[model samples]
Target chain A: MDERMTDAVLATEELTVRFGGHVAVDRVTCRFRAGELTAIVGPNGAGKTTYFNLISGQIPATGGRVLLGGRDVTRLSVAARTRLGVGRAFQLTNLFPDLSVLENVRLVIQSRRGRDFDMWSMAAAHADLAEAAEAVLERVRMTDLAGRKVAALSHGDQRKLEVAMLIALDPKVYMFDEPTAGMSVDEAPVVLELIAALKAQTDRTILLVEHKMDVIARLADRIIVLHNGALAADGPPREVIASDVVQEAYMGKALEDV
Target chain B: MLKRILSGDMPQSRALGLILLAILIGLAFAPFLFPGTRSLDTAARICVFVALAASYDLLLGYAGIVSFAHTMFFGLGAYGVALASDGMGRSFGALAAGSLAGALAAAALALLVGLFSLRVRAIFFAMITLAVASAVAVLFSQLSGITGGEDGLNYRIPRALTAAARYAEEPFLGMRLTGKVLNYYLVFFGALILFLALLRVVNSPFGRVLQAIRENEFRAEAIGCRVVWHRTAATVISAVSAALAGSLYAIWLRYVGPDTVLSFEIMVDILLMVVIGGMGTMYGAAVGAALFVLAQNYLQALMGAAAEAAAGVPGLPLILDPDRWLLWLGALFILSVYFFPTGVVGRLRGR
Candidate 1:
């Protein structure tokens, strides 16, 4: 609703990704404004995750460029992009299985704080790092499980921990790939509430690839519907759900309430 | 007492501190209690290999990088000290300076090797290091004028570090202060300090990242950690520690050769030490090195006596004979692996 909030944007210009004869993601152009939560909804194998990967620099783009805060970042590495304030959570839980919850969050904080290469100092001796990690954990309501090993945590808790890690990195743009894929119906709302809480914060951009239409409808300001590796619909949630093309491609039963 | 000083927040840190303390006391009192040159010699060898194996653990256990080029760096260190002694004349200053140079050279070589090779996957990285290591060994063996070819270089060390020089005339604790005893202390204190330094390095914040990378490199990269640079640093530190051990070995034996220092056998020995002692646990490196060096040195004699006793027994002598010691060693290695999968430390920890 605010014109100033729309000034900062991340856009893809004619992006394409091809694997031999098949194209995983076709040429697509879109923009996600700052301080807004945009949902990318599509069926399985619809290139939603792949497109997220392309923008996050996890996979090389076959053509076109990714603009991060208006700077061309197609050639930047995954780590370089992360340093430039791009954070992502995987579809599968990619975490340090052997490390404790506190340690897992602390590692991300340590890297962001520029202490990853500190050879002479002890990790525990850094009071500020612990405080910062604990602060993020507190925000995610995971401080009680800080000392627990990540492998022992439930799947929902692990996802929450991942969100905690992203908060520790404090990125400008957050890319969440199926953050609640494995959570039960009861557990899913907890994650949704966390995401909603983040969405309420000003000047933060979120690109979420979620399969739950209810989640997309509740939190998304704009919805980008992808079908067969191409952009089929891009507009507000209500307008996109009403579109016949979206209804035929993906919004069959999921958009019944709308 | 020393355990309290070296203990940390890590799991098994107290155990590591105890092992280091035991090594300190055992080697310091070895010459007095055993009262022989052979015992002193064995103690020095154990100290050297302990340092070498622990250095290797920094890479294999912490960084999760398997390298076959370890002995090449060891050889470089030995050669650095041996060649320096030959040119500068044996003195404390010369030996110290030479060892420093040698360690630096080894670290530099590790940096270069790691930078180029660490970009590949784990298995390919191992193969490339193996290839490069073999080439370096060949180069050393061929360069007869400088490296002494296959015969290797034999040079004198400082008098205080030699087995011939006597530090005192009167006996202390029923042990004579011969060159051997004095040299034993030199190697003992030097190896102790080096091992502890490496321990400090592994317990530091940087070592935490190294272990994180070991657990998951992709996640580490995703969190903005530079995997290659971290691995390169670990490799360099490991190489430098190995070089220190190699320098001590060169001074102890008063010789450095391709077969003795740069051979694949030494690298395999280091690997066995890590595996048997427990990879990742620094204390395990010391335990593994001590057990292996002692076994390699005396197992044949023990088997020889057994075979001689069973000479009249038909099939018994064949398997237990000293001449078939390699078979016995192979069996022991397998038994260790099967029984102590986590290593000796792992077994002691009841895991």
Candidate 2:
């Protein structure tokens, strides 16, 4: 950890990835500070998820590096980065489908508790973890569904389970890639509300990748626009959302119909 | 008491408990109740196969890893005992030394194979293990000086385990108090301990992690579970268990042969046992092994009797011939699968 608390919690320096002559994230450098939500907005194929992957160690960078608290972590594996406090919620709701919701969350607690290698004791012996996991589920208003299998859960509940799992992990940085992508319109706000509650704590950094402009406006304190795999605009929500560069690059031929 | 014994993993179904209980009691007293060499041999084979199939389930059912190299580990234990006994003479010390060496070697080989292949996709792992296992089987056949080549080695066990060594001058309850009975007890108890140990493992916290990795590999990794590390550890454990089962077999038979342990057919048999018993349940191994081994030993004879009774029927004798026992075995498996899709244990528990 960096001694200077005022410093950026996470910073990427000219992070670039080229997939067979097609540059995905092109020389993008950005810094994210604590107590703020930075939303990365762009059109499809604009490298939003790709950038998240590099920062969370999902995919490696071809050029430059990712620094966590001024420490280089570009070569670390996904599990190593997760251990270093980089929590990631997938775009497609990646979770243990066969396990019950409580078990799913309990496993994360066990992993964090460093008891994943305890081969002698039964899983049910750790009653404290089950309680703690239920508390996390409580936060997401999913206590009723905790005993049910994740495979039987609706898309909305599955997304909520992902949040509960993330909470159990308690990582320093929260990286949510379109947390409500496939959720129904009625179910989207519940997850967005959970993200909002986390942001209100004002002690953790959250990086969100979303396409909904209204969502970006309401949740994002700082907005960075990506166009054609390059950073086109970076500023506070007010100025960046109105910038001519963003409108031209992202809005996609504004006023063609009008 | 049962909960503590099972490490909090209950059978979860009354029918499953009864079936498993029947299997446990049947094997425990085979010498006294059956009172025949053939029945005793059948019971001992059931025990050995139970342990072997349970070990395979640890990989296939819990860890969700497909490994063709399992029998290779089984062979290593058999050969370890056979060669050590050959050199050191027939003694319990030789058996113990061979068993330990074989288990260690199996663990080491599993670690190597897991490291090289577990990192890739599941299908690639299946392919790699298939290739490696075939290579080892062929090597056992070619290593004439050490492994006894294709004929394999028929070695000796301790004198106390042989039929000649009687425990007493008089027969006990119409049964001979011979060393063969003592040896059968050794095998039965050894298998019982192994099965219970596997039960303890599957209900443990580490076993839950294996189940997690099996259910969702990507999420397990994202959740800070070292997928490969956990998988490799499981592989090593499973391999060691299989080797121990092979040691029990060597002690009982006083023979170590490639076809007995290293052949691909044994690997397929193990797969069948795991599937028929239920992949994830340890008790399923016992059920699957007992069912398959009994069908193998007696199904043909039963078919022979049926063939004689049906001799007058057109084309019925040919179908019922003992030579076509495999055809009936295939039909039995298909019917079991159709009725008990999750294997017998899973079906019992699902209710």
Candidate 3:
């Protein structure tokens, strides 16, 4: 355990955030390592999304530190954290609704290359960025819809575009907030396969906050469960699933209310 | 060649393309086509407004920043030139110096505003800009010695650009070959180049980032584009461009006053043009500015003619009264906004 501690790629030390008197994420202390896919499971308002927000620099932590490769990034902006190799995909399918799908992905590619601020050069003039964008879209099988406006895309396609943008960034730590929330049966498999491919690399950390237990069972090597803004369980997926703390935290409360 | 010039961002609609071309040709030969003092003045005003409106569009349309401070930047340019010409004497060097100074000052002030307020909510930022703009307007009027206070500053330009200096012995192409014609061309070409530069910018990588930010700022930040910095950069560029347009307006009028250049009405006019023409496209600025200026200048005369034609026709004559032209203009604006929520260009483009 002591030796494995040093190998952690991403770690949070007692991270917390408060909304007035209420705490959204409370003292989430955990170390995430490369070669691991950790699924964060929780009931609604379990602070799972808030924890992800804390780690990804969406909301500043009220206390404690977020360490990326042992360096504290608690005060960094979201873009600064992204530059430090942290990437995030939103639960809400955040995208450039007015732009074409190709331009949407191309913008991220340009940003990743640090060429987004080249004011004089035409974006179309840079064929390389477009080609790279196409390649990422191809991975998500969205090449046919390249010219389609994002607003015109179906919900599943928008989710695919969201993943394509994240792939374009190619960050070291992938933070996905409900990657397949609204995906259909067929669409979910495509996204799951892509996530599997990323996990196969085994040199980058993947953090997923999800409600789908089946997905957590299939892809997650380890599971971290949160209940009422506190960690309830953390261990191998099966052990964490069977743990009494998990059952009592959300399940028992839900059953009692029912 | 034209495609290259447009940076491959075509107007995308044939009718829109033709309309833009007609506007281009008409402005290019305005003095020759409509040879009169009032017409030339109207044409000059159109050129300056086109550039001004387009620069404002870069913020309101492309980047989705609501800024009322645009006229403040324009005022800075006008005053920059007014002071330079007033202090440095009538010379080409003074014009150049004033124009450059105005652009720089506008850019610097925009940078400060963006840094301080961009991180706030969009509506709040708009309020902040409104406050800043009104403050600047007040400052321009209060600083009497420097800005000429309420009376305003009347300055001269180089002999070559004034109406007294005739370049040729005879009028050419039914237009006098005087310094005034040269000044008109200067305004026309400067506006043209500035409009094209703005077009190119909207097609660039930086411009795409701005669109993305407008679409989803949090996602842009999550994807590694510093949202605030990008917004600030866009604000500076828009301010500088507006300042330059203000410089051209000052040169054309040979006077600088709060009412002439820095008025809030100018800002409201810019908003109307962008919305009426189309918000997101640069061509919208050209079309919107032309149409609005034409209506403002000629709509009353056209109404007077109609009123006379409808003499003793009950409500028709009363409705067509020249003094009530603004009522008709308001009705037209409402009709357009109702029929084309995306503006004329956006509706014409069919996307």
DockQ of each: 0.70, 0.79, 0.83
Better of 2 and 3 by DockQ: 3
lDDT of each: 0.86, 0.89, 0.91
lDDT by residue (A1-258, candidate 1, tens digit) is 345324756888889999998988999888777778999998999999999999988899999889888799999888888998889888888889888999999899889988888876556778898899899888777889999999999998888888778878878888888888887777677778877877888678899998888888889998998888889898889899888888876977878875
Clash count (model 3, backbone only): 0
How would you encode candidate 2's per-residue C-alpha lDDT over B34-62 as one tens digit per residue? 89899899999999999999989999999
What local lDDT score does residue B174 receive in model 1, on the 0 to 100 scale?
91
- TM-score for chain B of all predictions: 0.94, 0.98, 0.99
Give the better candidate number (2 or 3) by TM-score. 3
What tens digits encode model 3's per-residue C-alpha lDDT throughout A1-258?
666579988999899999999999889899999978999988899999899999999998999899999899999999999999999998988998988999988988899899978888788899999999999989888899999999999998999889888888888899888999888888888889989999999998999988777788789999998888988888997787777777676555532322
Model 3: pairs clashing at backbone N, Cα or C within 3 Å? none
Mind giving the per-residue lDDT tens digits that candidate 1 earns over B162-198? Answer: 6567778888889888887777777888888877777
Best by DockQ: 3
What's model 1's lDDT at B83?
87
- For candidate 3, what is the DockQ-based docking class? high
Candidate 2 ranges with C-alpha deviation above 4 Å: A1-6, A184-189, A251-258
lDDT measured at residue B222 in model 3 versus the true structure, 0 to 100: 89
Instruction: Give the 10-residue window scoring lowest on summed lDDT in candidate 2 chain B.
Output: B168-177
Candidate 2, DockQ score (0 to 1): 0.79
Ranking by DockQ: 3, 2, 1
Higher-scoring candidate on TM-score, 1 or 3 = 3
Query: Using TM-score as the measure, which candidate wins?
Result: 3
